[model samples]
Target: MKILFVNNGLAGGGVEKLLNDMLPLINESGNYCELLILFDDDAKYLESLRNNGVKVQIVPKKIYNKGHFQRILYIMNYIKNNDFDIVHANEFPLIYYCSIIKTILGKKMPKLVMTEHNTDNRRRHIKLSRPLEKLIYRNYDKVTSISDKVQEVLLDWLRPNDRDKYVVVYNGIAAENFRNSKPYERSDLVPEISEKDKLLCVIGSLTEQKNYFLC
Candidate 1:
């Protein structure tokens, strides 16, 4: 497939690393994978993608918040002008991008896919938002999430074309990385955790749905 990857940031973030892991497999299969960064301006971690001979494009955002508007035009032109089997995007903003543009252009849109990383993050702007999701859901061919928890949440918010459309593809670690690293002693990140006590960590953005507490 001729795939174009759209990402917001590429500073060795989890989403970028996910793309890094998948690019090798895509390259080995002799398929075309192109990288399009919405915010990245430097070659921070693009070496792997370049080394694998994948095409890269840094879509310059001439305007501020209007960058999303520019991306809509750029992507529409690319889709209308060239041949791309799939357009894969990570996170919600890019997902929202392709969804809106495809609606405006009608039938010439490419196949849309998403790799959602988190379950708790959701849209809170549109009330009774099921109608909006129902519309955008028609634009996406498939979605993959890291865990079943996320899949369940997605099924509730984002309707899919097929029941099996949402796949739980667990992220994998390389055997070489495991073999190279030695087991180190474990220590409590927080002080004074007894045997009866426990350590827990929660990860999410500063969004309100995350329910983070400060005190």
Candidate 2:
């Protein structure tokens, strides 16, 4: 199977990390795998993916700020040239883009898939975006939520018939990768930690969903 994973960029985030873990397995399954990163941010994970035999492609600079139609055209052209069988979008905007391809191009496009990694977002509450969101989501072959909570949140907003498209695909890590990993030394991140200072680490983005203010 030819599969393409689409994302805005491979920035440091949970979704990226999850994809990082999934790529190797995808390749090992004897399938052709590729990544379509919309914008370049000099992501740290780029090298690791290349090392693992995943082909990564970035959209050209000219298409970045033109408009939605132009960006969709760029994506659609890429999809056509690559002949991907499945296009799995990591974020919601890309889902809408894939939806457009499926809507206009019909069977000419690949099967559209989207994975929802977050429980909340601005689009759900915006009245004007709801109609478009509904239309796009209806075209997706599958919509996976990272957890049951996330599925519930999506169900609260998605239409009843669209509920059939929803599925809970909990995120997973590659446990074997940590099997032979060396223990971390103090100077790795914080040089201030002498050999004795106990360090408390918190991992999350500084977004409202993380609720870092309470921490």
Candidate 3:
């Protein structure tokens, strides 16, 4: 299968990391996988992806600078020319853009899939954006969420009649790394630690959506 994964950029984020880990595996399985990043800036995983034999393409600088519409046109042309079997979008505006392209292409467009990583986003808070959101999601052939909670919340928010289109695909991890790792001494890491003290670790980007303060 020929698949094109679209995202904003290859920044140091969970989505980027997921793509970094997932794309190579897809390629190794004999499926042709390519990445299309909207911006060329802050591409932390570009070299790593290329080293893994995943074809990574960025929007042309001239077209990127031209404005939103121009970039959309570029993406449309790129997808149309690539002849992909599937186009999986991984982030916000890119999801919206790909939906627009699918709507325009109709049956000519490839199978459109989007992964919803979060349970909430700014778009959900806007009262007027609901209708457009519904339309955008309707354009997708399938919508995947990172967890059951995310899928539940998304379905509740959109309330689409075709509930079967949504599915839960849990995020992956390199379990062997954890299984083969050594345990750290509590006293060595924290000299002030008590023998009976319990430690809690929270890992994620310190973004507003993470709600670190709540933790």
Candidate 4:
């Protein structure tokens, strides 16, 4: 199957890392997978993805600089020309654009899939956006979330009757890298602690959604 993964940009974020890890595996499984990103700013994983043989396409700078509407047109045109089997959108605005494209193209559009990465977003906080979000989500063939909590929150917010459309696909990591690496001695990194000292580690982006303050 020919798949096109769309996102806003390739910044150093969890979503970007997820795509960098996932696209290569998808292509290796006898399927054609390509990425369509809106911008090229601070694309930390761009080289890594290309090295792994995942085709990464970026919107032309001219079109991207014009405005949001122009970028949406470019995306629509690109999708129309690519003849992809599945267009999986990973983030906002692009998700909205892809949803709108599916709506406009109707049956002609490819199987539209979106991955909801966060349990909460600004759209959910806006009362007027709820109906619009429901309409946008309804156009998707499948809606996947990175965690059960994300899926639960999304379903509760959208209140869509077709509950089966939402699914939880947990984020994955390349565990072998951690397993194969040498373990670090606690004293080597932080000499202040002894063997008896209790320690806690938190790994995630320092975003409000992560709720680091709760720790």
lDDT of 4 by residue, 1-215 (tens): 99999998888988999899888888889999999999999999999999999989999999999988898889888989988999999888888999888877888899999999988888888999999999999999999998989998999999999999899999998787688798778987789998899777777876787888787
Candidate 1's C-alpha runs over 4 A off are 41-43, 63-65, 105-107, 122-126, 159-162, 184-215
Give the worst 10-residue stretch by lDDT in candidate 2.
155-164
Ranking by TM-score: 4, 3, 2, 1
* Tens-digit lDDT track of model 3 for 44-146: 9999999999999999899889988898899999999988999999888999999999888889999999999998999999989999999999999999999
Model 1 per-residue lDDT tens digits across residues 119-144: 76547345587777667666777878
Give lDDT tens digits, candidate 2, residues 14-34: 888887778878899898888
Could you tell me how far off, in angstroms, the CA of residue 135 lies in candidate 1 after the best superposition? 1.5
Q: What is the model-wide C-alpha lDDT for candidate 1?
A: 0.72
Question: Candidate 1: which pairs clash?
Answer: none
lDDT of 3 at 49: 97
Model 4 lDDT, full chain set:
0.90
The window of 10 residues in a row where model 4 has the poorest summed lDDT is 198-207
The most accurate candidate by lDDT is 3
Clashing residue pairs in candidate 4 (N, C-alpha, C atoms within 3 angstroms): none
Q: How does each model score on TM-score?
A: 0.74, 0.86, 0.91, 0.94
Residue 26, candidate 1: C-alpha displacement in angstroms: 1.3
**TM accuracy, model 2:** 0.86
For all candidates, what are the clash counts? 0, 0, 0, 0
